[model samples]
Target chain A: MAELSKTDQVEDLHLVNLTKRFGEVAAVDDLTLTIPAGSFFALLGASGCGKTTTLRMVAGLEDPTSGSIRIGDKDVTRLRAFKRPVNTVFQSYALFPHLDIFENVAFGLRRRGVKNIKPIVEAMLELVELGHLARRKPTQLSGGQQQRVAVARALINKPDVLLLDEPLGALDLKLRRQMQIELKRIQTEVGTTFVHVTHDQEEAMTMADTIAVMNAGRIEQMGSPAEIYELPRTVFVANFLGQSNLIEGRVSGAGEMLDVAAHERSFRLPRERSSATGASIILGVRPEKMTVLDAPDAARVPEGHNVLSGRVTDVSYTGVSTQYLVQASWGQELVVFEQNLIVGDRCEVGDEVVVHWSPRHSFGLDGNEDIHAGVDSAVLALESVDSAPAAGDGE
Target chain B: MAPVLPSAAVAPPSTVAQRRSRTGYVLLFPGMTWLAVFFAIPFVTLFVTSLQTPVPGKSGRYQLGLEFGNYATALAEYWPAFVRSFAYAGIATLLALIIGYPLAYFIAFRSGRWRGLMLVLVIAPSFASFLLRTYAWKTILADESPVTSFFNALHLLPDGRILNTSIAVIAGLTYNFLPFMVLPLYAALERIDPRLIEAANDLYASPVTAFRKITWPLSMPGVVAGTLLTFIPAAGDYINAELLGSTKDRMVGNAIQTNFIEFRDYPTASALSFALMAAILILVFTYIRRAGTEDLV
Candidate 1:
């Protein structure tokens, strides 16, 4: 039998091949990660993608089917949930209804046998800006106030790792936005390692320093937010985080520079960045990374920039920016986002246009992958937002 | 600037609608009148009868008069019975709570797929005749019964006499009222979000501490409701005492029943009954206030 390696470095929370199976289904498969100490990390995925389950496993609420969990150097795999040095801010805020705000915040200290808790509890309430409502029951507070109370209560324990399971999922859009900033500020001030699990990509991008995009119980990609967005390693990551246009092409050498061809239109693919050369590949570019101009303005295409001629299939005016779906000659609807430089002078549908982007903006992935994986779901989401005016109005 | 609508524009139509809406109150007339006749009228008659006095030196004969002394006599005579009634009921209520809380907790939190089956079993005994079930206990605890003999062999019972004792009466009360205690407790425990308990554990509370701080306090509303449901009925019950207790353990309810039926002393019986109702009301009110769950009722 091989003995498990026990390292001496005790800097972060580590999971070694943690797996949780609910009968025939594996909610969280063999997953391993090392979250650096004092860093704000996020597990991002759609619902049922195992992000929340992974968070629960880390919190010790759910026991692993196999493998171990460690906080710093201590192996806490078999430890009771209450004995772990971690706390959670549940999605529903689960405040103690019978307790007033002050007592609720003091619960942890009191449980740990601290007789003098007034000072700490009061300071925590003040920190959450809820000092005036210390005497109020949880039921009397609004959703946002209760959320802060939940945060304060968990944070008062001074746990080494704080897990937030979609803490702002219950709040309205405006309050959710406000709390995203508040949470980031609090994490920065306290310097506590925060592992936030959320399905909302915008929320994850706005708050986390490092993000692991999870899918089907495994991490599809893990990196800094910019890296995950600008240089995704999987087709799922490219479309899940934000909108991406994956242009199908065949990669080949084109003397002095490498290029990918699709329907006689070629785009640059740097040789050093090419992983699977001489094979069919997919070139990905973010909607905002590309620029659109009238076809007649072909001379405007800068040197060394890739260009494609297409006709605008659809245009959506969203106040800040306009999203255009261009039906390229390569037989794909390439999405392009442009700022509303001239509000009313937007390009109409069916207008001939040329799309151009720098070579560095292109991201390449294996062509034998699901091209339409996350696109339709995003479109359905947008359609729901459009159909329900109140949903969009709240945002 | 919008023009103000005149009151006549809405007043007449609303008045007509209000007239039509009186049918709702009219529909409630029968049930209201039934309660007034059956419940309210009898209560008033009982109050009057309690204030009456028996004709001088004549048995089974009473004259209506404002004789408050009837209450004094009943209280003076049956004070011990009143005390025993409340004591037996209080002990029975406490026992039911101690036993029922864990049963309810198990069913609510851990029964999983068998929850409905467990609840049915809790209520199954109530479907049979209450008297028949209590009679079954009498047979189970008979002097030569296996349970009593086993207890004697184990030396758990010094005398091995459980039948016709205060302990028997209290046991009968607890058994009969156990469902009342368990159901409300189960409801309260089931309504609680399991996540709250998880949150408690996450906040550094051991399982015991979580139960003490969260489960127990949150389930107080159920305790208050269950205790009242069990205690109030158990206080006024006479069947258990008559079947399982001797004269020494007779409660106020037995005295009232004996006075009204066998002795034909209506005035004293009515007085004793009124006293029991008043005492229970006061106790319930004080308890609810002290428990700080006044809003539950």
Candidate 2:
């Protein structure tokens, strides 16, 4: 009878203007985000950057100093953690050392004085692939096994949203990667919204449907992983998500098209607009965008388009690519990512090369577009997740 | 050139440690032997002595003869004392648990520095002498004291006296063992992870349910340790009974003490002591074993 109500559905969670302060410092400042039903979202930031704080606030383990939280339109800001329809898988797993896998998973169920624990606990263990280890105590378990048990325990309650606070933080690197894929797979399979917190950028980017990049207690930017990486909206976001080159320039002319200049050449804007003519501005270029324009095209690179002339100072060989550090006029070195093909002659230690990129690859260094769209809830963005092919995901 | 080169300073430490461990075991055996000889031997001897006959001419003396009849006689002679001791000890332990649990919990879970000061204060009365404190109760409860006048004015006590009663004996015993209860209980409840309480509360259980299911269960070891600490000594407390209780409230310990010292009845004393020890041991063992399953929150 109870199964008819929820219909195997997980509820969406929303944190509205969540601001938590510990004395003078605001751990999470005005964090407003909505997690869609059944999405895996990541709140990523460095230590003390408030990622964990936000997750705790959602779980009702920590009340925000000022904010409102909702689970499927039900206001639950003041609700106690046990009273909320959420559970957490702590970084340490925090599995009861005294309880076996079965008992640990059955904890929430038994506490509610719920009957029929055996079948429910068995199904939970089966879901996490831990049925074989149901009788083993937590102390006897490996870290990964403990993590699975923690997941089993939280999910057995059929919580609305599962908050995973660095659930993979205690694993070895090899285990971490393995769990990342496994976690993503599990999220998708279960269709339960998972709000994961971690300081590891690659982990967040690789797993989350949407990643919220936080800095200094405020969300810098949030978008789908691709949008965060390729279309970061702040200098912080750009720098935080992989690497990028920032160049100071001016919009010399404007129309249906616009022209901008960096150290050595004028380039076109990706989007034409009517604003700030002859005003000082900054330009952004990803490393892969700039390339070595060889003997012929190097001579006459055009304005508002592909063209850069800089001297390559250093080159290092990666397994599949060579990276060249190029010096420009502004006394700043521009990094260029060159394909290291076995058939092609890669640049040696030092060589003068014209690095060229089309305007589409260039963006303003000062990124503030859609900064007011309430930093897309990392949860909803996670709904559209497709991880960049990992070493074995392609297989 | 001022400092000489270190000449293999630690080269033989391993060998030295091995030799020391051998020597350590050799040295440890004697102390253990003495414990076996003195402590263990006497306990066994006393258990043997309990099987004896009462010397008919003496009022409270007996002689050893491996006679099982001494046990029956001892029980008959001191059954009331045995019951009274346990009853008083039970009440004292209950009082100690009720009073000390919160104090220990407050120290372990709530109050920070105050816990330390309170701990010192709890132990302070013990250091001065439990007998003196029992005597102080004598002054407070007697008809001659200011407390008597206060009680008389309040119409609380018709006789205006509380000393030499079962309640006074229990109070004395509780006071004597309060620190024992507080310390071990504090240690046990303190070991509980606070997060567990929060975790339980978060899982839709009320605060009371969380505490009962989680916090209380986890602190079982402490409960056993504290209860044992309080109950064992309170059961054996002869001084409190002698000082604060009349014949009606006298415990098994009083009977044993009177047989050994007042009547010079060594055999009867040993028999009474063994009986008290067996009963206390069983009580303690049962309380602890039951606590194990239920206390681990």
**Best-fitting candidate, scored by DockQ:** 1
- Model 2 segments more than 4 A misplaced: A1-9, A256-267, A271-280, A293-297, A300-307, A342-344, A367-395, B1-24, B48-64, B112-115, B139-161, B293-297
The lDDT values for all models are 0.86, 0.76
* Residues A1-395, model 2: lDDT tens digits: 23212328667788889999999999999988888888889888766789888888888888899989999979999988878889888867777766778988888998878897898788778867888988887777777788888887887787889889878766766777888998887777667788999877788989998888988688887889987777666666666666777766666653655667656667776653222333665567789877775435566555645666666788888867788888864567888887765476766555666777777776664423332222233322232222311222111
Best by TM-score: 1
Error of 1 at B266 (Å): 1.3
Residue A280 error, candidate 2, Å: 4.6
Candidate 1, residue B253: Cα displacement in angstroms equals 1.7
TM-score of each: 0.91, 0.85
* Predictions: Cα RMSD each: 5.4, 7.0
